[model samples]
Every structure is written in C-alpha cells, then in structure tokens.
Target: MAKFAVIGHKGRMGQALATAIEEAGHEFCVGIDLGGDPAPVIGQCDVVVDFSSPDALVGNVKAARSKGVPILIGTTGLEEAHFSAIDEAARDIPILQTGNTSLGITLLSALVKQAAERLGDDWDIEVLEMHHRMKVDAPSGTAKLLGEAAAEGRGVALDDKMDSGRHGQTGARTPGDIGFATLRGGTVAGDHSVIFAGNEERLTLAHSAENRMIFARGAVRAGGWLIGKPPARYTMHDVLDL
Candidate 1:
C-alpha cells in the first residue's frame, strides 16, 4: 500500500484526509501542520497531499521536490506567485493542483466548458458559490475553476472578462462577461451553480457538496493516481481521466 503524507494536519480538511487515507487502505506516513517542517518526513511518503494555507505552499512544494515525491495541492486562495512555485517544482516532480477535488466538480467543469462553447455570446454566464463561514476566500476556488472552464470554451482570458464584487452605481452588464456571486454561512460544505441566461430561457448547472468526506475521498484517490507518474503539472481532470 502507498504511504501518504498530509499537510495542514490540524485543519478540517486535513483531519478528513487522515480518515480518507486510512479508509483507502493506504498508510498515513506523516502529517505536517503550521510551523511544522515536512522535509523531515517527505522521503517516507509515496505522495503528499497539501490542504494547508497559502503561506506554507512554497516550502511544502520544495520539500516534496527534494524527496522526489509527487504532490497533490488542494489549497485554495493561491496567488500567481504560488502557481509559479508549483510550475517550477513540477519540472522535477509530478504536481497536481486544483481548487476543488470533488469528482463531481471535475465533470461539472467539463460540462460548463461544453455549454459555453455551444452557447452564443447572447447568453450571459454567472457563477454562484457558497461555503462555510470560516472559509476566508471570496468567490470560492471552485467558482473560479468553473469560470476558467467557461473562459476556455469561449477562447478568452478569464481575467479580462471576469466581473465580480458588483455594488453601487454599477452600470449595465457587459456582454460576454462572466459574473460571480459568493455566499458565506454556517457549516456549509459547499454549493456551486453556473447560470447561462439567454433572451427567453435560462439554464443552470449546479453541484452541492453534502460533506467534506467527498473532497477528502477525491484527494486520496488523486494522490494514489499521481504516484510514479512523470514529472509535470496536473489537474483533477487528469486524475479522473476526463
């Protein structure tokens, strides 16, 4: 059985990952938390799954690369610099990074891409997401993933077309723009919906996460899939073979 190391071992996702690894018949090699160094234990692991804060990402990637261990990053709210670090590390070791690890969300992204491609510019696209009250990021990472999928289908940059944080005196909606709405509440696992609004009809695609175990299970599966793979940047789509 594969040995798995979990980063952010004290957080909600980390705890869930621990249970998932055991349930998947894998050995839990180590768990690294805030201020804990992973380099000491990374060599013992077949793969590393990180659900830690953004601040710890660079160090975590470095440790995994040093040990030549593949890593699956489930941490959200990453900035461009974080991606740059991941990209650099990926040159030496396999790396899978995603905002959401749910198998359903991966399929949802593909469907969103297909829908965006088939629909004309006349349809306005909007993404809505809700998360637990403790989640710090706005427009949850899953929402951005869906928006990126839509943008990919439309053959445009999401940054140029993304419209978020609408308030006071915002004029008419821009054509071909993708909008995002976020909601935070008590103990929500997660909920995401993408709406395509046309002249006379509307289509909404949605996914609701019942619990954290779904993500945990997916992460475990991804970690297993990544073992012994070639060094490269990867996504959940690769894990699902989508």
Candidate 2:
C-alpha cells in the first residue's frame, strides 16, 4: 500500500482525497491544513497530493522535493509564477498538475480539441462554468483549461483571444474570440459547458460534477500511478492514459 500526505486537509477536496486514499487501500501519512506543518510527515509519504491554495504551493513543493517524492497538485487559481515554480520543482521530482482531475473532464478536453479543430473560427467559441459560492476564483480553472483546449485546436493563444466578461454596452462579439462566463451559488460541485455558435447551428459540450469524490478518487489514482515515475511534469491525461 502507498502512503500519501493530503495538503489542505480541512478543505472539501482535501477531505475527499483523504477518504478516497483510504478507500483505495492506501494510508494517509499526514493531513496538513492551514498552519499545519507538512514537513514533519513529508518524508513518510510515498507521494504527496496537493489540493491546497496557491499561497501554500511553493512551500509544499519545496518540502516534497527535499524528500524526492512525487506530487500531484490539484490546486487552482495558479498564476504564471506558480507554474514556473512547479516547473523548477519538476526538475527534481515528478509533478502532476491539472485544473480538474475528473476522468470526464479529461475526455471532454480531448473532444473539445477535436471539435475546435474541425469548426472554423467563424463558429465562435465560449466557455461557461459554475462552482460553489465559497470558491474564490472567477472563470474557474476548468474553464481556463477548456479555453486552452479550444485555443489549441484553433491554433491560437487563449490569452490573446479570450473575452473574459462583458459589462454595460459591450459592442459586437469579437470574431475568433473565446468568451468565458462564470457563475457562483449554492453547492455546485462544478459545471462547465463549451459552446460553438455558428450562423445557423450551435453545439454545446458539457459536464456536471455531482460531487467532489470523482476528483478525489482520480487524484488518489494519479498519485498511485506516479510512484516510481521519472521526475517530470504530468497531467490527468497521463494518469488516465487519455
């Protein structure tokens, strides 16, 4: 059985990952929340799973790298600096990170890429996502991931083409722009839809998460697969072999 340390253990995803790890016949080396010291238990773990905040990421990566342990980072709201840190950490330890870990999202991403590739830019793409009210980030990370997928398929950069929000009298919809809409309310685990709007037709691809367990289980499974893996960056697609 493998041993894992769950960062942000008091939060929803961390708690879910803990339950999932135990159900998977694995052991929890430690559960670190805010103000909890994970360094003490970092060495005991065969792997580390981070569902913590962006603020806690660098320190956690440092702790994990010191022990030469593989880490699966599920924390969202990351900036470019955070990814740079992850990339540096990956030089010494295997690091698998994703906006969402659900198997459905992984498959959905692939399908989005294919659809975007086939659809002309004139079709117009938009991504909408909703999450629980407590979630702090807007446009949800999964929305960005989907946007990136659509952008990749279109042979364009998401940053350049993304139309994040519209207020007041925003003029006409920019051609070739990938728009994003966000909603926050209730206890939605997560919901995302990508729309391809053409002149006479529209196609919508979507996924709704009933609960957090799907992501939790996926993260645990990814941690298990990461053991003994060579040091490098990876994703859920790597874990699910998508």
- In order, candidate lDDTs are 0.96, 0.92
What is the C-alpha RMSD, rounded to one decimal, of candidate 1?
0.6
The TM-score of predicted model 2 comes to 0.97
Error of 2 at 167 (Å): 0.6
Top TM-score model:
1
User: What ranges in model 1 sit over 4 Å off?
Assistant: none
In the range 1-242, model 1's lDDT, one tens digit per residue, is 89999999888999999999999999999999999999988898899999999999999999999999999999999999999999999999999999999999999999999999999999999999999899999888899999999999999999999999799999999999999999999999999999999999999999999999999999999999999999999999998888
Q: RMSD in angstroms, all models? A: 0.6, 1.0
Best by lDDT: 1
Clashing pairs in 1: none
Q: Model 1's lDDT to the true fold?
A: 0.96
Looking at model 2, which ten-residue stretch has the lowest summed lDDT? 33-42
